[model samples]
Target: MAHYLPTIGFGEWVTTVGEVVHFTGYERPLDTLKLADPRDVKLGHLLGTADMIAQMADRCYLEKCRDRLYPEFVLGGVALPLSANGDRAIKYASGLDLLRQTPEFMMETRKKRLDQTFNQAYRYIEPLFDGTNPYLDAIERSLDFLKQVLRSESWRLLRRNPQVFAAQPDSMTNVRGLMVGYFKKVWSPD
Candidate 1:
């Protein structure tokens, strides 16, 4: 059986580690004299961690992007377009609907947002890791994988029969899980 991380609240775990390790970030006092030499303290940057990124790449990131976060963005009136009368017109009922209408556009939009978010976070908390950022590469690979899945026949089938797809017992518990299984079957990673 494959393990999957929760889509939300994982960042808190990372933050907790930083707190315990006495990292420079996360509200630690800058003016106080350090008991231990700052040079000796190796800050563990979670942003580009390999295991986290791999798990994210496996499903969490994609699931969040497809089902929860994207839908929230659309529903929250952030991505809605204005009507001719200057009122907000909902173009798509949900993120799934948006994807169904324009899969390519939605995929591109999601990818662009992911890039922007990751880059912004990296800039904010400059990682001290000497080696290359594995998370970025993983994100790119995952996005590519997601794009391929979006274009797959299984995705089309799901879109065509959204109600039926949603009605399945597995999907009833977690639609994202169902979709992930479908994606795994449809698009074998290289």
Candidate 2:
């Protein structure tokens, strides 16, 4: 019976932690992630951590590039009255009002960052697996699937009209089914 950290809401958990500590202002998580006795840390924990990182990268790819951050960028910026640390609102961009990048460009930039982040995180834990790392393969497959999704008509439609959910409820069902079915096919063992 291998124990693994539950990955559900893992991205939001990380985001909350960052917000609480004012991004890059804390090191406790890094310092305390591993047990004092290295041997006491199970392989499952290492794998789970890497998997969670990959999932986080995926979430960031969507949120930062497609769904949230990009839209905020286009609309001036996030509407937070104060910074995460409760100080004045941080000007995250230079001449934010003058910036005009397309969603496609944002997605490409974010996908590159996602690749770097995921690869580095997974590389740290790869040595423990002795060359048979199914998680890495799964992550690659997921990236490929995401690429396909980005080119899909459903995704384009949603991007064009973020309010599609309210306008046509069945569209959500189609998107959900597409995601679920593609993941099942790619992840299932042959």
Candidate 3:
């Protein structure tokens, strides 16, 4: 959930980035859950490792959203909010409306903005891992793949069948494998 916010539009967080970041436990530590008691060390380690793996899976799902789901929604005419509503504002335009209004510049600008936002959001979750964050690694890999998709002549195929593109080598299966492999290495029931 927190990882997804990085890909969110600026309009979505104009006034609430702090709240969103805080609510996502951006600065919090999982170490707080570690028990001081000696007997519970093993259990605590297992639980913490499990939580980390879960976060990694969450990151993989977010990548899937960026690579596959978002295009579906946009092409499908799924309405999305373009900006935060003000107290005095009676109505607001959808993202599609904004695009339709200014197709020439909006698409490129929007993509840049979304990419920047995603990077900023990634920074928030980064410190939680102290340089060992699997979720951040997953997002970086997805972003690299996304860059390739945008650069090549294959974007149309991606738009037509995202599921296929999503299933490629660095897709969810590999992400899962990374998480599972990490878990196996870090946690052992001795």
**Ranking of all candidate structures by their lDDT, best first:** 1, 2, 3
Candidate 2: Cα lDDT at 175: 47
Query: For every model in order, what is the number of clashing pairs?
Result: 0, 0, 1
Better of 2 and 3 by lDDT: 2
Model 3 regions lying over 4 Å from their true place: 1-63, 66-131, 156-190
State the lDDT of candidate 1 residue by residue for 70-184, as single tens digits: 5455434444656679765656555555544444553453354323322333333336555455555555676566557666735543332222234456643464454455445
> Number of the top candidate by TM-score?
1
Cα displacement (Å) at residue 88, model 3? 18
Candidate 2 local Cα displacement, residue 99, angstroms: 21
What ordering of candidates by TM-score runs from best to worst?
1, 2, 3
In candidate 3, which residue pairs get closer than 3 Å at backbone N, Cα or C atoms, i.e. clash?
A: 6-118
lDDT, model 3, position 52: 33
**lDDT of candidate 1 vs native?**
0.44
The stretch of ten residues in a row with the least summed lDDT in candidate 3 is: 86-95
What TM-score would you give candidate 3 relative to the actual structure?
A: 0.26
Instruction: Please give the CA lDDT of all the candidate structures.
Output: 0.44, 0.41, 0.40
> lDDT tens digits, residues 1-190, model 2?
0122125535534533333332121234434443444433333234434445454345234322454443343244242235668654533332222122333333443354324322333456567788555555654554554556555634542333343434666755554455456445534776
